[model samples]
Target chain A: MENLIDIKGVRHAYDTAAGKLPVLDGLEVSVKEGGFCAVVGPSGCGKSTLTRLIAGLMHPDEGEVWLHGEQVKGPRSTVGMAFQNPVLLEWRTILQNVMLPLEIVPGGLKGKAAVERAESLLALVGLEGFEDKRPSELSGGMRQRASLCRALVHQPDVLILDEPFGALDAFTREDLWQTMHEVKAKEPFTAVLITHDLRESIFLGDQVVVLSGRPARTQYVMEITRDGPPKLDDLYTPEASERLATLRHQIEIAQGRAEEGVSA
Target chain B: MTGTLRKILVPTAAMIIFLILWEALVWVMGWPNYKMASPSDLIPAYERYWELFLIMGWQTLWRTVLGLLLAIIVGTAIGMIMGFSRTMRDALYPLLVGFNAIPKATVVPIVALMFVGAHDFNTVLIAFMISFFPIAVSVSIGLSTLEPEYRDILRSLGASQTTIFWKIALPKTLPEFFGALKVSVTLAFIGTNLMEIVSPHGRGLGALFDSGKTNSDYPLMFAVLIALALLGIVLYYVVVALEKVFAGWAERQPG
Candidate 1:
């Protein structure tokens, strides 16, 4: 399979009033075309920063980021992202919100055609006939779905979700996990997801990369090799329990090491 | 009192008792008719003044409307530009702050004089000066207050700058628009009145007030004062109603 994205030995640091501080140390990750990769880590493991680097929102201080084998310099229009917050525009109706990306792209496709594409995307997310309601009127789950539609409306090649369902109720979050799977199953796109939930990582990911804490480094990149995605019932099975235990053990060791460093 | 009576009837009876006491005070005090006009006297004034007030109010309304329209156009455009770029904001904000600090009332006479007594222009300038700052500041604040997440989401989607402005920035903060308009509309009326007073020739409530002050006809002065107060109340509520229509989305949002 052709690699859609390749991050080669990337390093990032922040220059603050306190002085220089490294966040990512020689970070390396890759994803093939039509792949859905989840990155899971302990808190402050620089997971979110990795997504920013992948999307080219910020430049890696060292090494290179490649999308489709080209150097990542700035933002690529072919990339879509959803954050923890839905971040919908209060004044716009649901349909108009979805159409936003279509209008924002350069030399944008316009008129009836663009609107129709937007409508189709919204319907795909099960938001049909709700194009006119404002974001504030929608439930958190619905608003997040609308945000997803807005991200996908432009037909981006890459999708990045940074804990997209973090703010939702568990029931709603589970519902969205299935909805996301349905979208991916139908029309596959290269994806990078950063999440804290073990179940979410196992359910949606082809591969999950675990990270070390503070001046974080990749500890392990675990490949979830189930023949097909396991259902919610699988969350408590022996096999699932084994994987979950291993992941928790790695994170706990990383946390213990970081606490010793602070004490030192 | 029953269920409805416990709430509505008590308030209603209280209000009626208050009004009756007021009426009885006037009757017992034998106040001069002109000094303290009764409901009966005021009712006739309402009937006689309604048509003439409408005509005169229309003239003032147009002046105020034109001035406010200009402010919205110029202010929103400048504000959007400034808010979109930090460089523009840094360059222009000091000048705007300086202008904002200038007492607008002091400029009205000069503006009126400079325009060679064009009453409409004077009113427009007054409205522009009084209302422009709030509209510009409000629009800039609204534009800048956008969540970084919303902006980042757009960037990831490869949204064009124009679309971001139109869809996200404009619609997301309509409550601010209505808020700016409410404040500016009041300033619009004030601007028209200022110009009317300075020019001393235009036909508006301000001109009527001027003539009343000049002639020492206290009744006419009282009449003009009453009319102006009613006009202010009407203008205020009109903006409030418009805000309700435009900012329904804002109401749904959590504070």
Candidate 2:
């Protein structure tokens, strides 16, 4: 598979009242076309910064971020994003909210075509009856589903999930992970998921990348081999346990709790 | 009761109780009509000066409404400019605060003198000057405080600042805008009345109130006050209605 997203030696810093706060230092990552890459790291490890860099919302001070072999010079309309808060506009209905990107992204969809596309995506996320409902009327989980539909409405080249499920309860998060797989199977786009949950990373991602503490760099990368679509029961299996254990150890190392030489 | 019925019924009942209390208080005190006119006195006053009240009320209403409309346009423009740029906000905010701090009543004379012989224009000018501040402040706050996540979602789609403003900022700030309008509507009335009272051009409800004061016609003075209050209430409701139409999503169910 061809690399759809490539971040090489990305370094970024924020100028603060105190001084320059370095966030990303020599960070490197790549996700192949149609691949789900989950990035895990310590709190404030600049995982969110990495997503912005990939989405072209911001640029790195040094190194390159290439999407489909082209360097990102500025914000790209081809990127879709969802945050942990869902952040759906209170003024627009769920369907209208989903169609928001379509309106902004030029030559995407229009009129009846846009409505139909948004309705179909809403249906895919099991939000069929909520087409006319406001964002406040929906539950947290439901709002997140609508947010996901909005992100994908324009058929963007890359979809970025920045801790999108962090605020949801465990059960809701797991259900959304399944919904994510179903959506991706139909939509077929490369994705970068920034998450804190190790299980969530493994359950949804084909490959999980771990990052070290502040001024984060790619610490380790683990690829999961699964025979079929992910199932909740598979999480309890021996192979899954082994993968989880290895990833947990990597996270502990990333958080500087354990040494790299220590065996798991 | 349904929400709408209760909304209307509660205020109506309150007004009736208030009027009865005022009538009883005046009757018990045995105050003469010139010293204090009760609600009962207002009816005869209305009958005697119905034509004057109608004409003056119309003048005041139109001036206030016109000034409010101008304020909306100018305030929204200034708010958007400030909202879009930090440099502009920083530069303009202090000046706005200082201008707003000075009493609008004091400025009415200045405005009347500046545009002498233009009574209506002066009245409208004072109304605009008084009301625009709330609107500009509300709109700026609304724009500046927009959620970062929403901006990221739009910017990631390569949306221009103009597109963001039209699609997100305007709609998002509507609740605040309407809030400001409600406050501005009342302020506009004050501005109009101030001009009418200070530099009475022999027009508007304020002028009628002033003439009644001079003649010691207590009932007529109170009548004009009631008319002004009624106008303010009507205009405030108009703003509330517009808010429901534009920013109904912000209205949450009362717990």
Candidate 3:
């Protein structure tokens, strides 16, 4: 597999009223084509900023962000994103909201084709009857599902999930994780999921990258080895327990609670 | 009752009760019509001067509508410009606030003097000036406070500024826009009436009120006031109707 996204020594800072606040420092990450990269870190570790850099919504003050072997110079229509809030337009129906990117991106789907594409994605997400429903009409979980459809509707080269399921209850989050696998199996695309939940990261990601505290840098990378697709029951196994413990320890180290080469 | 019916019926019932209370008060006091004209007393005035009332009311209505339309165009343009750029907003906001702080009544005389004898134009001008501030302010707030997430979603898709404005910003701002319009329409009527009262253009309900005041015709004066209130109510409902059509999504309740 070829590398679809490569972030090399990416550094960024925000110029606040107080002064410049560094967010990302010497961060490095890469995701092969059709691979899922879950990035976990401490709170305010600049995970969201990393998503923006990948989406080309903003540029790093230093270093490079490459997508498909090309350095990102500006916003790219080939990137799709979903945030934790699932900010669907109140003015559009679920289907129409899903089709929003198609309406904006040049040479994208139009008219009946756009509607069909949106409708199909909705059906895939089990939102078939919700086509004409407004975003507010749906439950939080349903709305998030619709948002995922919206993000993928344009067939973007890269999909970025910026804590998209952070607001959901545990049950809803797990269901979405399974739905995510189902969707990815059908519609292939490289993805970067920024999450706080260790289980979520291990379940959804092939490669999990951990970052240190504020002004974050990649601290550790763990690749999950599974004989078959991930299942909820697998999370209760000893192997899964060991991986979770190790990741939890890594997070403590990242948060500066424990030093490197120390056992808890 | 259905929500829509209740919305209309409640206000209608309340108005009827209010009018009955006023009539009872007048009858109990036994004041002369010149001192206080009840709703019944205004009926004879309406019958006698029906044609005059029609012409004047039409004049006031048209002027208010015309001025409000112009205000919408100019206010939306200014608001969008201010919303899109921090420099423009910073440069223009303080000036707008200062101008809006001035009494529009005082400005009426200045406008009447500048365009002397252009009574209709002066009325429209004052209406536009008085009503545009709320619109510009509301629109600017709506745009500036737009959820950055929505913008990020569109921008990542390489959406142009114009496309974002039309698809997201404009639709999202509609609830606020209509809210401002509800306020602006009333202000427009006040502006038109203010010009008519201050400068006595002899063509609107305000002028009718002035003539009735000078002649001590209390019933006619009351009739003009009623006419203006009715017009305002009608225009208000029109805006509410438009709000339903354009931004109905904002009013939805969770299922």
* Chain B TM-score in each of the candidates: 0.80, 0.96, 0.95
Ranking by lDDT: 3, 2, 1
Q: Give candidates' CA RMSD values in order.
A: 5.1, 1.7, 1.7
Q: Per-residue lDDT tens digits of candidate 2, residues A74-159? A: 89889999999999999889999999999988798999999999999999999999999989899999999999999999999899
Q: Which stretches of candidate 1 lie over 4 Å from their true place?
A: A15-21, A42-45, A104-133, A253-264, B1-59, B86-118, B198-203, B233-255
* Runs of candidate 3 exceeding 4 Å displacement: B1-11, B253-255
What lDDT would candidate 3 get against the real structure? Answer: 0.93
**Reference contacts preserved by each model:** 0.85, 0.98, 0.98
lDDT (Cα, tens digit) per residue for candidate 1, span B1-255: 697779778967886786578667767888765555444344555565567567777778778778888998989988898888889999989999998888777888788678876777677778777888888888888898888887777766555677677767887667887888888888878878877776766778777667756876445555666677667777778888788886776775455
For candidate 2, lDDT tens digit of each residue in B1-255? Answer: 998999999999999999999999999999988888999999999999999998999999999999999999999999988987899999999999999999998898788789888999999999999999999999999999999898899998989988888899999999999989999999999999999998855589999999999998999999999999999999999889988888888998666
TM-score per candidate, chains pooled: 0.82, 0.96, 0.97
DockQ for candidate 3, C-alpha atoms: 0.86
Roughly what TM-score does model 1 have, to 2 decimal places? 0.82
Q: How many residue pairs clash in each candidate?
A: 4, 0, 0
DockQ metric for all predictions: 0.56, 0.84, 0.86
Tell me the lDDT of model 1 at B200.
62
Candidate 3, position B3, lDDT: 90
For DockQ, candidate 1 versus 2, the one ahead is 2
| Cα lDDT for residue B85, candidate 3 | 90
Cα lDDT listed for each candidate: 0.79, 0.93, 0.93
Looking at candidate 1 chain A, the ten consecutive residues that score lowest on lDDT are A255-264
